[model samples]
Target: MSSNVGTSDSASIYRRSRRQPLAITSAVIGTTLEWFDYSVYAAVAAWIATEFFPSENSHVSLLSALAVFGVGFFFRPLGALFFGHMGDRKGRKHALAATIILMGASSLLIAVAPNYTSVGLLAPVLLVVARCAQGFSAGGEFAGGAAFLIEGAPEKRRGTYGAIHYMAIIFGNLLGAAIVASLIAVLSGDQMKLWGWRIPFLIGACAALVGLFLRARSTDTPIMQQAIMAGEIPDSPISETFRDMWKLVLRGVGLVCGFTIVTYAYVNMQSYIPAVTGLSAGTAQWLYSLSLAVQIPLIGFFGFLSDKVGRKPLMLAGAVLLTVCPIPVFALVATGSTPLVLLALIIVSVSIAVYAGPFTAAITELMPRRTRYTALSVSYGLAAALFGGTAGYVVTWLRFYTASPNAPAIYAAIAAALTLITVISTPETVHRDISK
Candidate 1:
């Protein structure tokens, strides 16, 4: 069976499709809700620990709660497998719609879940179940959302459309931060521990609700729709993707690692810099926000540039910049001045923006449409499970074990070098015929 049926009419029509805007909106909203869910949970993890993971040692309880959250990582690949198959066999719309509702319901479940004081071990058990469901939903979200958005885009405009995926995530996280901060400001410490934390979950559920409504009204991408109408949807996309596209998966994993490490490491500066350096938490946060402010506006420009100059040059440059960043990093930290740190943070943000701007569009274009959803999801889910969540972790450990703040810089460099190697070997896919 041929993987894709090339069709200019479908692509052209879909570019002009009335549903294109709606499709993009649905995917973006869904993606935002997914990340918002993550940010909210992390923000309230301590309360969750106290409420559901009571322990003799407070540290142990917190670790246990975090461990339960980490369990979501294990479920992500499974969700990818399940949704990938559904997407290829049924349709992207089906899988996305299902995931959105399930994700929302999962958040609601957590919001209303009983605490350890009320339910013994069942409280933690319920929390685990809800979090696992959330993980499963998120597993499919990135790939599904990207494919959905990019496939609807005009061939030349896909890069900018893809950048919106990353933008939505940033907004979700910022929204979470704002929401949590407001909750903290309005509530007393006791009230926060007792109930305020659940408010974010409720808000996340509401975001999911809006996304679901949008998705319910949306159509599958033009490429996927063309495949379905032509009887081209894969009957067994799971095994087929693994058998035929494993090399692509390997390359995708490398890209995921590099992208996640560089981008997340910078994003998490506020999380760890205070512990490692004399930077105050408030100062770190403002510096982080300033960086985000700088990067957010430029992502679209870099993505648009990718459309003009192709993805390879921009990505390769960004990768190389990250690889040799240790000297600059050391120089900036040596001064320990707030102004210098802010300047350094903005530079890091631009590097990440240059690299990530075209990343999703490039990766989405690489996969064959017959099993695009499955292949993309499996590769991404696997890489993210392994290394995507490790950026901050690796930094923390490297600093601890080596007792040098500069030690953590190698983690990002190694990941970037791996990505650079992969990018060097891959052909420029900016002009690749994704319809095939």
Candidate 2:
């Protein structure tokens, strides 16, 4: 968040803006770009080790790369504080624009970064700087983007709009997986090690430019506009977040923890742990993308359904499924039977859709509009930093010591079971008026 201390004119455009489609576009494109940054970076972690962290041996280099990757997660909470404050005080529009631009710039830097051989230690340093920027930008993107989209929606349609953000995440993941799979199929190992990895980052950079255009042209959400006119913006959102909204922040963190751990840790089964599925790499990636595609319409449908039935039931059902389903899903995946593996992925995606549909609206609605952006960002950032950031490492560490392939699934279940308790205690927010 900028401390330049200038008044923002972000609310000015909302009155003239009747085009909600543009607001939706701005949200989807910007979010897709932010998530695509993570997807591609995770896919290329090994190659990144060779390019920027040529230390000790291949194993050590890969670990170093992974460490750098995890380093980005630590910066997320910082970004949340910075951009959340910006969104609350400067207006959501300014925060949205700044985040997209920073993300785009970071992607561009990574795309053209020098290899260790060419620039010595400076190469890895540059990589870290870029990754940190990415993490910081992501920290605020989701909370701000969700608040922005939901604020612009019709009362009956907030869930549907919120679901678009989740759809964009899936789309971003699929896009990254597809592109990386395509390049790996076309390029030789040496080619991929040398220059092939840059292609995806370049494409991500280009996508961010599109996000900037959409956000720049769009207005702030109407709810945010009203908050501005009513003089409800906070002077110190961080203080308020810890003081008055502490309970809501805890609820927000619990709701987000299991959801992100599962989404980030396991939807990536084929990419990171392909042997678990016992399928050819290309075949697994394609089927994985296809199976997850099932979540798209289901998310939209469930979102609309939540608007009718209320958010708690759907979230409770999803949490129940997430707690119990991962073990069985991975059990099916381990069989090496292609059909069973595909079915398993679909089952999990549906569970995700069930949770994903209403979680954003339910969580955001927990806070008053004045502190919604900051509080949401802080809680979510903390969850990502704590659970999401450590998910892969914890799963891998457990699998190594326990000699059980079910480690990741078990980890997901335990975290989700925790979330189930939180959701059960939370009130239904569908009928609440958020503009206050």
Candidate 3:
């Protein structure tokens, strides 16, 4: 009997080992779909306003569309609260699957949305509603997905696996960039602004369907299964998470502020720089995409290094560099030289990868198993809303307020300062077991 029991246990372990790669793949794919949907908004921001918010006053139309963009960021914290609780109480897989479904629906609606010419003010209103849905889904998706990846990975290999989470983001950006590049190549400038822009969002909606298919097969983590069997998981994980893991939540906010600034500088800033700094929009987009392509592999290298050294040293280095480099980086872009712009973007992109690489596992391991999702979701969601989501607006306002083109430097400096303060307070989670 003992021999038979040992054989069964061995088989089970072997089966689980085989599933790890698939789980990671699903996590990456799901995250890619979410970001593909989210990032497309920024990638096509200029064209999107022309389509949805067409009006006599170009500035009002653009601001309205961008405000809709910001609306998505604001609703994410609510999604985080709702789905984070569900992940802790129900299961991570279920929460992720549901969020992706909602994300797909929202993307589809944006794809088919009527223009302001056709529907009047209601057009922008509907756009906000769809974006909010996407935001809420996104709010919950990453924290749940990160928690799932951490729980699924082996303790010693957590950072490597966690790196795979950011790998998905790189893939998503690459795919979005590729789509934009392809569109730019084939379509006439007028065609692109009018209708070609809709193709990417349509593609995003379809990609979500593919992600859902992948996520359907993912198995629950052992930690979650054990909690279910023991009946130790809280019935109201949000309340319990708030009570027990608020410190981790604050740490998450600080760390995510760093990530958001990097994203804004590297990703969203490209869209606005053309109008504000007199750079060509196409030139700026090309630089942004090229920098991301270079940064993807660097993200993997930094993540791997974090596992060897620690998350704090790498993150702190990146934060300090961001503070120092923002002025030089933006000043170079303001020169309107393609080579200079590319150089500036690549410098900023590489620096951002340090935090992006290890943050998945680092954030997940901060809280106990029962409150992990809730704590992480609140921290990440709020930070993204306050810092990441508003980055474009803040920089634009700064420029408008000071009438100085180098306003992005001030934004980057603020983010770096916040991150520096938080780095001191956060615990090292690289060597810890998150699934427990």
Candidate 4:
């Protein structure tokens, strides 16, 4: 009887070990698909402008398209509120599954949306509605996914596991860039403007369907299960989080503001480079994609390093470098040399990875378990909406107003300085026990 019991216990343990990786894979797939959907709009914004926001002045059309893109971000905080409550009250698995479905549906809607030429004013109106839906789903997907991964991970490996959440983001961006580049390579510019833009959105919808299937098979994390069994789940997580954990939420905003600014600048640069430098659009896309690909392994390296040294030190180092490096890097990019531009992008990507890799784990540790999903979603969603969503539009307007090629670099530097202040004030959380 004792031998039989031991054998059964060993088999159960093995089964659990197998399940853990599947859980992580589900998180990765969901995050990747969400970001992929978001980025497709960005990747094809120029084409979207011509097809959906026609204007005599090309610049006016581009600005209008970007404005619509920014508008989507405004809905994120609302999504966070609704979905965060679901995750806290029901389960992370349930919230994530719902988010993936919403995102997939929105992307499909965008793919099939009629052009302005066909539907007139209603076309742009429909596009805005779909983008807002995507923004809402994304508001929950990231923070909810982060909380899921962090809770499921081994106590000591939280940083490394949380890093994967971000890695999926980078991978998703890379995928979008690659798809855009390939389309550009094969299609004439006129063809792209006519219909090529819709293809990426279609691809994004299909990818999201695959992600939803994977997520459906996964279970809630052990920490969430424990909370449910103990009846520790909050009745109103958003209200409870703000009422008691307001300070932590403020700190999260401060920490995220600079990261959002830097990241969006990097994302918009793919479009910026070709417009300003007269580089081949395909070449520019390839270079940006390559930089992101290289940064993935570097991100993992930094995440592992944080477990040994600490999250704060790596983050602080990154903040300082970002504050100081942008002016010089942008100068190199202005030279318009392919080699110089590639080098500058690579350096900036490395700095971004250093701080971003450990960010999710650190923040997860800071908030209490019961209200973590809601608090994190609210804080991150707000910062991303206010800073990240507006970055491309703001930078373009600054460049136009100042008539200076270096305006974006100055903006990044200021954002980085503000982040450095937050890093100094925030305590290290890598060693904290998150389950408490």
Local accuracy by lDDT, each model: 0.79, 0.82, 0.80, 0.86
Give model 3's TM-score versus the native structure: 0.95
Candidate 3, RMSD to the unseen true structure: 1.8
lDDT of 1 by residue, 30-107 (tens): 888887777666556667878998788765665566567667766889999999999889888999999999999999
lDDT of 2 by residue, 333-392 (tens): 878787888888888889999999988788877878888889989989899888887776
Candidate 1: stretches off by over 4 Å:
1-17, 49-65, 117-120, 266-270, 273-287, 325-344, 397-402
Ranking by TM-score: 4, 3, 2, 1
Candidate 1 TM-score to native: 0.87
Q: State residue 10's C-alpha deviation in candidate 3, in Å.
A: 4.6
Worst 10 residues of 2 by lDDT: 3-12
Q: Candidate 3: deviation at residue 121, Å?
A: 1.3
In model 4, residue pairs whose N, Cα or C atoms come closer than 3 Å (at least 3 residues apart or on different chains), thus clashing, are none
Residue-level lDDT of model 4, residues 1-436, one tens digit each, is 9999999999988987999888998888878887676566677888888888999987778778888888888888999898889999999999999898889888898889999999999999989999899889888988898999999988778889988988998898899899999999999999998888889889888888888888899999888999999999898999999999899988988888888888888888777777668688888899999999988888888877888888899989988877887888788778889999999899889988988888888888888898888888888889889988888888767766677878889998899889889999999998787777
Runs with alpha carbons beyond 4 Å of true place in candidate 4:
1-9
Model 3 worst lDDT run, 10 consecutive residues: 392-401
lDDT of 3 by residue, 167-219 (tens): 78877877776687678778999988778878988998888888788789888
